[model samples]
Target: MVSIGEFGSKIKENISRVIVGKEKTIERVLAVLISGGHVLINDVPGVGKTMLARSLAISLGLEFNRLQCTPDLLPGDVTGISILNLKTNEFNFRKGPIFTQILLVDEINRTTPRTQSALLEAMAERQVTVDGRSFQMEKPFFVIATQNPVEFEGTFPLPEAQLDRFSISLTMGYPDEQSERKLLKGISDEHPITSLKPVSGQDELDSVLKQVKEVEIEDSVLQYIISIVNETRSHRDIQLGVSPRGSIALMETARALAGIRGRRFVIPDDVKETACDILSHRIIIKPEARLMRRTNRDVINEIVESLPIPINNEKT
Candidate 1:
């Protein structure tokens, strides 16, 4: 039997066959998968953002469903609507695309804000409410939404509320020449993604998620996370800070990172590595701050630098 670590590596290798020069992005995708958390892939077109999501779904052995967001999309479209069953003379709920274990929402920003907000409930709760009824989703559910960063022609940017629901947001930057060369050499007239197979089953995924939960963090690290959130809230250039749920995402992602490193403990590095992806999307800078040309990366760096690094047991 292959160890889980080996299995994880195989999954990464399989994905890289299709998406070149993105080892870190692959690891982030894996971390979010094992963490059982949703993700937002924000990048320019033709950068393989959607391909990454599809590759991940195939590699992880999860059921994949994709929706191309458009202005015509309705809330009932993503989350199934209730209807009257003529024979039974009663209303019955039918599941939508979001019902699957792995859902890829491609070009999510292409849809209207009203249609986009419809996902807020599903992404955050992992369930849908229809006709005044709530339904719980099965285990191993996750959403991987993609957006084109360079195009604003007809796109509606995700609101801060919906953005906070994602555990991480990332861009798939251009591949290096060597990586692109390798990618060009791998073609056999068919997409590599079709040949890809799952590295682990949903059961294995659930087990790994359990392991992620087992990873522990010290109280000092908890304080560090809080300090960062507070700083963002009080920053003169910022209009909003990460919500409590965002703090939870940071803590959860830190544990998942530690687990990926084969450890049952978390350190400050795990938190720092995840802070930007986790917090940047959740904040909104003031107009003056934006005019000052300050970026989300800058704010994240400043907050991270201001926090005192915690010493481990050796310091005590």
Candidate 2:
């Protein structure tokens, strides 16, 4: 069996064939997948958010599907609908794109609130209900949703409930000049991702996911996580704080990060590294904070920075 770090590296190297730079973002995505969670890629258009999802799906050898969300998109369009079959004189159900293992919801913010709510159940419960019947999703179901900036035209901001369902939110900033030049030079009629192939198999994926649950997290580190979460609730600048789910996500993500780095135990750095990504979207900043130009990321970072690291040399 391959180590988690080796598995992570294999996928990262394979994805790099198409996705240039952004190594940290790729790693975080892998960690989230191992933790059995979804990702929200929030960025301006043309930053390769969709491409990143495609490359990841291809590299993981998972069943892939893409939904181009629009204002006309409906709940049934995402969760599927029951149809009357005249031949059988009964209702038959047709599965939608959400049935796939790796579902890339492109421009998710463009969809209506009713349509967006359709995904909440699936994301949180890994199942969909149609006409009083519930269908369980396939194993390894993961959602990689991409959205344009909420400030962009014709986009609806995802409600906090929807945002909390996502384990982590990431940004694919414009690649550096060197990386861009490399990308430009490498461009061809066929995209680089088309030639990319899976490097890891289902067995490895399952093993790593199982092992992530076993990754040791010390008491001190657990307290550290709680401290950060508790602070969020009382912070004067914030109106709403992260829920218990956020702390759970932080702990699970830290475990995955430890496994990805080839460590059997989690450290403070893992939590610190993933806190902003996992907790930023889970929080709601006050209007006063926004007026002061404090973004969610900024508030999360501030909280993380203020916390004292537990004294431990077990796995630094």
Candidate 3:
């Protein structure tokens, strides 16, 4: 079986053909998917959010589907509908893009709250309901939903319930000067994404994902994760805190990160590294905190830094 590190490296190298100077971001996204969690990418347009999703799906050899969300997009459009079969005279179910292994929801905030709610069940349960029937999603299902942080004009902010369903939220910032230069040179007459290929097959990915769940973490580290979540609940400037789901997400992603780094045991650094991205979106800040320019990231960072690391690293 291929090691997790090797699998991650191959996927990252293959994706590098299309995306530039975002190794850390790629690693985090890979970890989230390996941990069986969806991603919420909050960023400005033209930063390769869609391209990144496509590259990752291709690298993993997953069935990829893109849904460009609009205000008019409906629940049935995302989850499919039941239609009458002409010959059989029975209602036949037609699958939507949500049935795919990897679904990229572009400009998700532009869709109505009703349409947005359609994804909640799929993201949380990996299944969709139509005509009072439940349909199970195939294994390795993942979502990479994107929203423009700078533009709110016809966009509806994701409700707290929707936000909490995402395992990790990140921004793919603009690449550095050298990487941008390489990007420009690589895209003369043709795009690099057109030539990208799958680095590993589904079986290998499944094996690696299984191993990620088996990655070990000490009891001390687990308590540390709980402490971080607890801090958010009582923080003076915060109106809401990270939920238990956020804690689980942090631990799961940390395990995946450890596996990706070729470690059988998770350490403090793994928890610390994955905490902000996993917990930031799950938090709700007060109006006063926003006026003070204190973002969720700031509060998460303060909590993470103020907490003490587990000195006991010996695995049980």
After superposition, candidate 1 runs with Cα above 4 Å error: 1-7, 314-316
- TM-score of model 1 (CA atoms): 0.93
The segments of candidate 3 whose C-alpha lies over 4 angstroms from its true place after superposition are 313-316
lDDT, candidate 2, 125-172, per-residue tens:
989999999999977989999888755688888998999999999998
**How well is each residue in 1-316 modelled by candidate 1, as lDDT tens digits?**
4333555687788888889899888888888877767899988788887788888888877788998898789988988989999999999999888888878899899999888887888777777888899988767788889988778898888887878788999888888999888888987889787787776676777667666776778998898889898899999888877789889988988877776766678898889988998889888888898899998878888889878888787322
Which has the higher lDDT value, candidate number 1 or candidate number 2?
2
lDDT value, residue 27 of candidate 2: 90
Give the 10-residue window scoring lowest on summed lDDT in candidate 1: 1-10
The CA-based lDDT of model 3 is what? 0.92
- Model 2: residue 131 alpha-carbon error in angstroms: 0.6
How does model 2 fare in lDDT? 0.91
lDDT of 3 by residue, 1-316 (tens): 9989888888989998899999899999999999999999999899999999999988888899999999999999999999999999999999988899999999999999999999999999988999899999978889999999888799999999999999999999999999999998888677888888888889999899888878888898999999999999999978999899999999999999988888898999999988999999988889999999999999999999999998874663
Model 1 global lDDT (CA atoms, 0 to 1): 0.83
Report the C-alpha displacement of residue 255, candidate 3, in angstroms: 0.4
